[model samples]
Target: MSSLSILLVEDDTIEVMKLNRTISKLNLNHTVIEMKNGELALEYLNGDHKLPDIILLDLNMPKLNGIDFLSILKEDNELKHIPTIILTTSCNQKDLQECYNLGVTGYILKPLRYEEYVTKIEKIVAYWSINELIQKK
Candidate 1:
């Protein structure tokens, strides 16, 4: 299988580091395209580039938050079909409901333990890697 290209929209430096380490351990050779916030991510997406197979989004971000980002993404005809997963520390039911309503493919909480977090990420990547995704023209 070809390595999955991932777009990760996150602001926390430590979280990004941990995610990179976890992905490296999985040995999938996946390419991670990092963006500091939703606005920056949008810039990358709008530019002439290949769209990522999936998006890992964080709810808490400066400039444009995850909810707002999702809203914008879902509205765009060309970009709406890509699967977006929420990886956040937020346990709020409202946030969860909102994300689900906005069309998030999966919602995963950031566990307190590093091992647990890694495991969650591993499962997510594994599932997405094997599943067939619809390619938009």
Candidate 2:
């Protein structure tokens, strides 16, 4: 499979480290672009940087949460088509409904165990890596 550029919008420092380790463990040849919040993510998306193949977003953040980002992204003509998947711990029905309303591609609940998290991330990476994606660049 071709290498993919992935955008990750998250706020937790430890989660970032864990995710990095998991990605390395999975041995997928993909580049991850990190942003601390949705506002920063939007800035990155609007900049000259290459568009990512997919986005892995967290729901709860300090500024510009995932739902807000999804609302903005899904309305944009240029960026709306990128597949966005939510990776979060929240199991609230409201969150799920809102994300679906905003057009997220998929929603994954973060597992408690490290092994489970790695396995979930592995599946996510593998799927997105092999799945045919629409290129905007």
Candidate 3:
């Protein structure tokens, strides 16, 4: 299997660190590209760089929020194919509905416990990896 590439757009330094540690501990056969804000993420996605298989997007960000980013992404022909997952602290139903409406593949609330967070991420990675393989087959 090819290593999965993940683009993570999160603004909080603490959250970023936690996610980085979780990914490292999981030892997932994936490459993670990190960005601090939605605008920067959009720039990266629009550039000549290879598109990530999955995007781990945070809802609240500077310059542009996840909903706005998703709206733009869904409209772009070149970027519409990539799957985006909302990984956020908010569990608001309205936000969830909005994300689904904007075509996010998944929505995961940030876990308060470190162990739970790692476990959740692992499951997400496993599911996506398997799903991709099945699609190819």
Model 3 earns a TM-score of 0.93
Q: Once superposed on the true structure, which residue ranges of model 3 sit more than 4 Å away at CA?
A: 133-137
Give lDDT: candidate 3, residue 85: 92
Q: Which 10-residue span in candidate 3 carries the lowest summed lDDT? A: 128-137
Please tell me which model should have the higher TM-score, number 1 or number 3.
Answer: 1
Write candidate 1's Cα lDDT for 74-133 as tens digits: 988889888899999999999999999988898999999999998999888887777778
Tens digits of per-residue lDDT, candidate 3, 1-137, equal: 44678899999989888887888898767888999998999999999998888899999998999999999999999988788999999999999999999899899999899999999999888877777642562
Candidate 2, 95-133: lDDT as tens digits: 999999989999999999999999899888888877866
- Give the per-residue Cα lDDT of candidate 1 at 120: 97
What's the TM for model 1?
Answer: 0.95
> For model 1, how many clashes?
0
> Model 3 clash pairs?
none
